[model samples]
Target: MACLSRHRHHHHHHHHHRAWLTSPDPDMLHHRPLSAHHRPLPHDDALPPLLRTPHPPRLRHGRHRPHPRPQFDGPDPIWDAVRQEAKREVVQFNSLCASVASIAFLVFHFNCVQAEKEPILSSFLYASILAHDCLEQALVFVLANRLQNPTLLATQLLDIFSNVVLHHKPIQRSIRLDVQAFKDRDPACLSYCSALLYMKGFHALQVYRIAHALWHQGRKVLALALQSRVSEVFGVDIHPAAKIGEGILLDHGTGVVIGETAIVGNRVSLLHGVTLGGTGKEIGDRHPKVGEGALIGASATILGNITIGEGAMIAAGSLVLKDVPPHSIAAGIPAKVICGLQEHDPSLTMKHDATKDFFTHVATNFRDEMPNG
Candidate 1:
């Protein structure tokens, strides 16, 4: 995975490298007509025309004459050529146009591969650059009509979703961290791109992000509609009202349910079939509040307003009702604190049957390897 720092560095380098293009040197001007001396104006012709001021301020007869400039009565070939070149450069650099061109290249590559021809690395590289938002765009397209507006175009849908979720800086940062969480925590996740594109858990979480934002903005109807689409598509039901922190992994997301008023903390891992629901008939704030770095195992049902403390680990198939202390392991029906974990964050380690301390295990292995002394 490429770090954001590296991307910023590259972007900075690109701007610095092209710094000269923004300010032309007076000794190399060639695009326009020569001055009063009939000698070419001092300017750098190598500078791209887009950055070069179209009408450069020139000194004529020792006076700054703004008008009576080199007038092209007809289409001057030199000016026309510069204008065409600038248009081509602008189109090439436009991100949206690049993305569209990338899609075409990807389709061509797919066809070539299907025909048993060799895949092109150059094509794949080009596609990867512009297709970073492909998954997000696809998600928007999938839920475009969820609001029941049949006349909305795909581009409009993209803009709507981008404004609500994708374009927000905080949401974008959360998504990158979410993808990193999937890559680091899930053994099956091959790469950052794989997590971004293929993981339904990731997809479900991102949709919830969009819904969560809309919900706060008082678009309750649209938020609920998105919630419905998420449940139908991903089998993971998280209420728009639920509060979830970043770096969360809803592993094997099928059948995972997080109810309204539920609070899941940062770096928490919830396995498949886990439920954070209410104890029943209570009106306000009934769902469980899971702490940061907590690991809830498969089929674990945590109910009420109980706190699964930070770094707590709940064993698989457990029924948790009471509050579980931090760094403790809870298990069995109506789960109890069976033991404590030496590992600081069980969510990071994902060790289910860790009875002894992690260091104890390491020391035991070391002892076994040593000769009798």
Candidate 2:
């Protein structure tokens, strides 16, 4: 009877070990043997492999492999290069202006000493140069010179204009490009210093940029005020709301008038007495959209929501009311398409001979003379 009891006990121990190995509950693997009521049912080897094995969260490749690191982090190289180039240009331009001012001071001082007179002009030059050490300071000085009134002192005006220029980086860049545009396009502009010091067009454009900034910031009263002063002083009446791109050449810019909603594209050349205006009492986007690299000759009047296409040329005194196609010449009153453009950008070439080209084409094509009556 004792032997039979021992055999029964061993049989029960073997059955429990088998049940633990083949259990469906993975928790059973980690825990100590459960109480009789809490024990899990035994599973068979015939159960599916997925049911038998628990899958932990995993990396995509495999458990042993590691993820790769990124090659770069931060600003892109192309943008970095562009920003660096702009900075270099600004520094070079400022240095050139300073050098020119120094030379002028020396020349004026020597002349005064030779003549045995008070160095009045030399003193003014020195003071001006001392007051304006950089382009932003110079621009503020110019604006203050014109815009200061009984209510506003030059210093007060300087502070306001300085804040607008210093706080906005794009305005500074635009100023640099504007200087470059003058040097590139205007044969009369001997250097960047000449443009900075003497070009009224450059002065007008920079002031307009400040006013435009004010307009965007909801200082409409101040913006309009600046606009009025600019028109009064420079004779260039560009509305504060007008959008003008970089590298614009407002050559001999006096009497130039850009309307409220006008949009002028990059590298455009507008000569004296040009009017980008509305027709009669019309309002709401009633101004021309002048495209990139276009040339508007002296006194050209482009009116009322018309698109002056890229690289198109408007002859002097032409009245443009319709959309001029890209790379074409529009001439005459109620301007007609005189001829297709041969040059890529007549503005850059500084050519105002569209009428000559038109006449030449007509002469060449119309071989038969007018029928002899």
Candidate 3:
């Protein structure tokens, strides 16, 4: 027993040390408000003659214009997942304790009597369950990387376990550094974060993570099969071929769909009854393409070959039939650009700003239309 505990401690520290030595600090990357639903900006979803790709901030005259990032520190999602996993860990620990105690007591009291029969299987089963959770945690990391190939922070999980009932003993030196470099997105997007947490509550959402890891490991069929099971259990369908990114939450998640060819970026969120489906009989590249930081609202239907750009918001009950630009809000039966995704004034989110922008655009065009008035 002592030997096993000692081995576990050594294994933990080794991982931490290696990750730090190899990977750069994740904090160095710009941290943004990584929720699916951030406030909209001033723009329309439909293409404007002047519109271009919404690139990150550029070097102004050889000086770096910082990426539009969050102003403060935020809660880490990986740590949050760890906190969640830890609750399971505690239950496992209790089971382990109980089984061990029961077995010990039986042996002490009925020494040769029970020793002559079959050994206890309950403890072994419970111990396997506990081991399953640990395996789940490790497998989740692989899935995240599969969904989005980028610099993923490994430390947020370290902090979560640190505060929980179990810590991966002594801790790995590199993982500690990974935690130290961990940059969690701002929690101001908690509504989205909360939704993702809710999705995790579903039966084996972590299965996708494992499948994702498997796909990367050259086991495509097995990966898709696992995803198929995840869809059956969770009612949330994500295509293994579809490229996804970091910090995304599939909230409420029932009937949430992703097409076989859909592309999703980091920190995006999709709510219940959301569809990323096709419009025609077209086969290859027929589905919609969604950009980074985009939000697809509840029961919204986005059909055909379209680009819903970065930071765009598709309001609830809307039918998106065309391309929607970055930083715009598309709502209504056949959704058009009602407003941009980044709306500054709180009073303007509800139909008011769209009206104001409409008049503002009209007033600016009045001179070209009518010389008087």
Candidate 4:
């Protein structure tokens, strides 16, 4: 009985050991149920593609995928259009100048061939027209005749002026437009060559452009000097800091005073003695802002920081103290709005006559509105 009991006890111990090895403890298998501070990682689907660390699947076909392209912004369309127009104008003006020069050369050659006498006129023509290649070279030669002095030699001045004009694309465009403006607006300007060779208004504008460029570059002393020269030569006192735009027509430009803070817009016309000036001793921004397509008649004095509206007409000798409305005809001493203007630009028409009936009505209304005192 003792031997049988020993055998059963051994058998039971062996069975218990087998069961423990076959099945692990439930608490140990679960890994002690993660602590409150130790949370499980987020699923791959919850993360952004860039942040996710999952491996990409292998392609069945052996081809690789192409990457997507990046996008960028381009230049403004209006500015691009402006640039294109300027380029076209420059090309046309240059071509016209070249043709004129060519014709002049042919005439000089014919005179030399036909006449037996000394070719004095031919020599002059060769020096003036046949010698130069472009409008800019001709301008440099012409300006040199007047601008050369003891302190600044003609050659040195020419180099400086050429560098300024050639380096600046805007200056070239402005020059072409200014020439076109003269041709379009001034009756005296019979030809492009005549405007280039003779017009004081055109000359003054080009000098001012150079001075303005210098002023922007922080060479104020040289700019002021050029301004003084322009004033002396052309009698047009345009401050170097004044902002004048393209297609400007300064008719009989003598005594035209544009102040330092003045702003003249594109396609504007100003007759002789027109002053875009300050009213008093005030400092900052104390000048007139002349709008596009506005016409200021001869001797019109527009003062202060007021706006002369687009397509507005200020009658001759009028003194404007306040803002003029757009497309309105302003007249009288203090310059009241006499009547509304037509859709066309008055500057282009070169017309100063406001309707006589409209002027009469305005005068009548003014008298009626006045007190009995």
Model with the higher TM-score, candidate 2 or 3: 2
Best by lDDT: 2
- Using all chains and alpha carbons, the TM-scores for the candidates as numbered come to 0.60, 0.65, 0.48, 0.64
| Model 3 C-alpha lDDT versus the unseen true structure | 0.45
Task: Estimate, for each residue in 10-34, the C-alpha lDDT of model 1 and write its tens digit.
Answer: 1111111111112222211223443
Runs off by more than 4 Å, candidate 4: 1-126, 355-373
Q: What is the overall TM-score of model 4 with all chains considered together?
A: 0.64
Work out candidate 4's RMSD over C-alphas.
Answer: 33.6
Lowest summed-lDDT stretch of 10 residues in model 1? 2-11
**All candidates: CA RMSD (Å):** 17.7, 30.8, 20.4, 33.6
| Residue range 1-373, candidate 2, lDDT tens digits | 0100000011112122211112222211122343444223224232222112121212223341121111222222221222222222232333223333212311012232332343243323222332222455555655665567766666566657877886676676577667667877899876555576578888899989999999999999999988888888789999999999877899988999999999998778999999999998977989999998899999999999999999999998889999999999998788999778988877778888658866566566676566756
The list of candidate 2 runs beyond 4 A from truth reads 1-121, 357-373
Candidate 3: give its CA RMSD in angstroms: 20.4
lDDT winner between candidates 2 and 3: 2
Candidate 3 error regions (>4 Å):
1-198, 201-206, 212-218, 343-373
Query: Considering lDDT, where higher is better, how would the candidates rank from best to worst?
Result: 2, 4, 1, 3
lDDT string for model 4 (173-239, tens) is 5666676677768988765555665788888888889889999999999999988887987899999
